[model samples]
Target chain A: MLFDVQGTATDFFTTVTSDAVRIDLGRNPGLNWDDFVNRWRVAYFAAVAATPTPAGTWTSVHSIYRRTLDALLDEAGVEYPDTDREELTLAWQRLIPWPDTVQGLRRLGVRYTLATLSNADVSAVVNLSKRGGLQWDAIFTAEMVGAFKPDPATYSTAARYLGLPHSEIMMVASHKYDIRAAAALGFQTAFVARPLEFGPAAEADTEYDDAFDLNASDFLDLADQLDA
Target chain B: MLFDVQGTATDFFTTVTSDAVRIDLGRNPGLNWDDFVNRWRVAYFAAVAATPTPAGTWTSVHSIYRRTLDALLDEAGVEYPDTDREELTLAWQRLIPWPDTVQGLRRLGVRYTLATLSNADVSAVVNLSKRGGLQWDAIFTAEMVGAFKPDPATYSTAARYLGLPHSEIMMVASHKYDIRAAAALGFQTAFVARPLEFGPAAEADTEYDDAFDLNASDFLDLADQLDA
Candidate 1:
């Protein structure tokens, strides 16, 4: 549930397959990974930025991410292909859990409830849990709430579902923006540092402040910090 | 925080302490543990039975239990010393984990999300998790939804908050009624056969059929099933 893109799971960008995707772009002379990434990023932001606020409240991360993905495909002039959006979405379901994730979560499991409050769909999370060998009493996602993280409702709803007070539940994430919103709502927060989340340190913003209740280098360190 | 009332935790039942006020129930000229427990049981059920339902919904365990206690005191012509209620409540908060609960959860934690969706309040669940040394990704209770088990809302709310579909979430319980309701709402269901949940050989009417996806004799067995 507390996952980052790229480096957290498989080193996709460095993998032969991902490198091939990049190579294909490079060979197109007019297109490159950087340009393609930039274009997708722009479309992602534009789509999220354009979403109408509901009853004066901001749009949720769930909505933003979903719309962002839609916009990126549209702007790229690419169709979803035979896999369709649902199967493509299932990619998240089969993502490899980080090498340390299973053991770390196992250790933490000795002392706390471990769940992923991700942007993935419920079925995706279920399949991911099954495939990754990650067990959770619950797997929460933005899709369930029809909104995304950084939204108070998402965190609050999670706590409410767990039958816990906001203060009693802790939101552990690799993103500051996610933790900041959780903290504002009175939930305890833990930061799991995923330095190469976006690719490499040079391309990633790996710096974070000591604003969380606890910060760790990885899931194992997090387990140590929680005394699991 | 899977726990048994009599054997697991030291703090659950009311202890006969000199500091605690005693209601001399004329029926049991002498205060015995059995007598006290019988009276408490009656108070507990009566309280639950008296609660006013919402529309078609039933009264929650908390409301029923608290009210029942209050009414029992009134019927016995006894006034509980202020300390008595606090001590009794504290006892509830102090339930000990079953011996297998901690280790079993740790094992299951390696493969699944483990949580307590109980009738206990959030505080009680949190405290139990801490006292019993059990780690749950989330702890759910009726207080979160303002409704008790067997109500569709409780399960639905839990699924929504965890960002999971009802089907992806599984409910593990000793009570058949709870499992039935959860299954009815599309949650994967498992029943832990607490044959002695009520007392020695006093079966709890735990009949298993197609409703449950898995049924096991204990937490360890549940772990094995899920792991397999």
Candidate 2:
């Protein structure tokens, strides 16, 4: 099973917003960190989708995070030192896994080879995996594929490296677009709902749909459904 | 640390020779399974070195292993069914780790990120890691790099994906050639002696030399030397 690391395995919404709240505690008591974090994520997704592919040249997720953070901070009228800005940008690297994530992954790993095919940079994913105590068999990323999620090259690159037919490799993600892209390329899709992925104010769409091969409430539920 | 999986971590010689002995038990009592396994290793090395890279097409180590096994069986006058040949070639996928491999990796993983930079295919390394109870942070291979060990592209691809300067990522291997190649590309080199890498009948070159930055008897010793 190939996992999408950002929200499905690790709880990025809580981690990032918590970091933002902690960093901006005294300076901006009125700031809604949850909204700020969600907006930042929307910017990230847009930036990655719009990032240009110039053949040999590469743009790292670290740089993208930095760019998005600078723009977001300016738009929000927030002031922070360069070091704090760098730390805030690096919050993605220190994301914490959900309560059921580690045990569920361990159980699933026993019966299946579990890996990450994340949109994050390889280094970011590596650091996140280590910080979250994730035991991934392999880490594949947009940095390796030279493209972001939803790109045909991304899924194909992962499938090629896995040496498995697209039909045999299952894509598990909290995001519908990621799974849809994988499904279009012949991969099995599992929609794992992270209802608080946009924080408490926003509820993610968790209703079961015919589009995905499986719908799971969480990692543990996914493991149970897969009989792992 | 980047590890060479086939020998430094796993006891492939013992695993392959035992499989050969079990499979060819009644077929040839005079056959030296140990020697046969050693020769097979040599053939594998040669084939990987000689595999062609024609632009975008890939040559997986699994295919290389199959090719080498067929040639070796023909040369050794050992006739086996195609299914048996396939099983024997896949012995590489189920190699057992050395006694200290798991414990030492756990110790090292506490301090430094540990990954594989092997010549094996990604899926093969994933299976071998799972079978041998190895907990690697990431798996990088020749198949991912589109070339074999000792090739500049192989080492560079790993360093690039790791988002680390070659000097920051230590390359650990039992073979001097593997370490030397990595060292030439500025990767820190650790020579871990696997005295039985070539089987008990053949003595491996275990002498510590100035060429490598660190030399240890085993993974545990390496962990101690690194203060992990």
Candidate 3:
């Protein structure tokens, strides 16, 4: 079993609200929640898209997040806050799980060796698992492979850690990109729809148009599909 | 939540019966179950006591088990056989939880973050957790630290990985040595007594006189003490 973090198990907006208030009041005098959310979105996607080049050049997710956030601040006619990037990163740690996440994961834990194969670091995943009351057999991270999702090596390494072949393991997520990556590598894929992942009235194009092995509307639905 | 692997979870002697028969058939050409049990007792303790020192450079639990079996053969005046160690180890994988273990662990899991900090490798522990229907928040192993139990680093690292301070985490084990070590490192200790860990008639020392934070007759007793 697998899980996603932000926008899946956790509410990205709630986490940003508290973090924005904390950061804005402390060092940044006029930063607003909307500005923080937009900057965070830019940072999040930039991190997902950056990659290493063939010339041995490396572009880290953290670096991408930092650069993208800086550019967003500039575009918004605002100066980049003098807050520590590490402190900003720690905001991700305080994310609240979705309403169904805890109970759904508890149910799944009864049958499968549930794990999180997300882009989150091992430490972040461990912290989230503890706070969310999620029991995971193993916590695999992009940090372990030094690469992000859509990389076969990450999925293969996760399977190796689970002591199972790719065919025996399943990757469960709300993101088609992640599920598609695992599917191409021979893993069973399950999708959980997150209609409000980007917030109300935001068009997410929440459809698994790509060929995925299984799709569900929520974690409970995923559990039903797997158990059935 | 912790578990005692031997009689508390699985019948150790019964599981290894085929392995014992194969060894006897290849070596002495004829040996009884009594002889096999005797040899196994020596091998098991010897395996436990033969931890590597700095200069000695201890081996992994897998390698130690292999060497211990070899020594057992030599002591029993038998020859080494080509019996499958992996298959024999898989018998360990199929361990049955004591009638109380499942209920006890389920109760404990409701309150605390349950995990297995075992001498068993990650794969072995994961398999046992699956087979026993155990839902652990994390499954840690000596393999993570490349060191066995009684090492402070192992307990400390396990606690650290849980994102908890040593005092917040607890070490639960049947072995006094494991609890003592963990207690010295500031982790709360709970000892679950297993008088027949060695054998029923074996006259092994059963009293846990160490200063463990809590000592109980069984996992259920432990659950009671922990207010689970």
**Candidate number with greatest TM-score:** 2
For every candidate, what share of the true interface contacts is present?
A: 0.14, 0.86, 0.56
Candidate 3, residues A91-156, lDDT tens digits: the string is: 666667888888788788777777787776555676667776766767666655556777787888
Q: Quote each prediction's TM-score.
A: 0.62, 0.96, 0.72
Give the per-residue lDDT of model 1 (tens digit) for A78-117. Answer: 5554334434333434556667778987788667765667
lDDT of model number 1: 0.58
Total clashes, candidate 1?
A: 25
Instruction: Enumerate the candidates' DockQ scores in order.
Output: 0.15, 0.80, 0.37
Q: How high is the lDDT of residue A94 in model 3? A: 61
- Model 1 spans > 4 angstroms off: A1-70, A80-84, A94-147, A153-173, A182-193, A208-228, B1-67, B73-84, B90-117, B122-146, B155-173, B180-193, B201-203, B206-227
Error of 3 at A29 (Å): 12
| Native interface contacts retained, candidate 2 | 0.86
Model 2, residue pairs in steric clash:
none
**Candidate 3 ranges with C-alpha deviation above 4 Å:** A14-35, A41-96, A99-111, A121-127, A130-135, A142-154, A180-185, A223-227, B1-86
Per DockQ, what order, best first? 2, 3, 1
lDDT of 1 by residue, B1-228 (tens): 222222222223333221123433343344444444446655664454355546424344544545655665566665666556555545555566655677777788666655566666565566556666766655556655566666787788667555677888778776677777888888888777655444342335556666688877777887787773
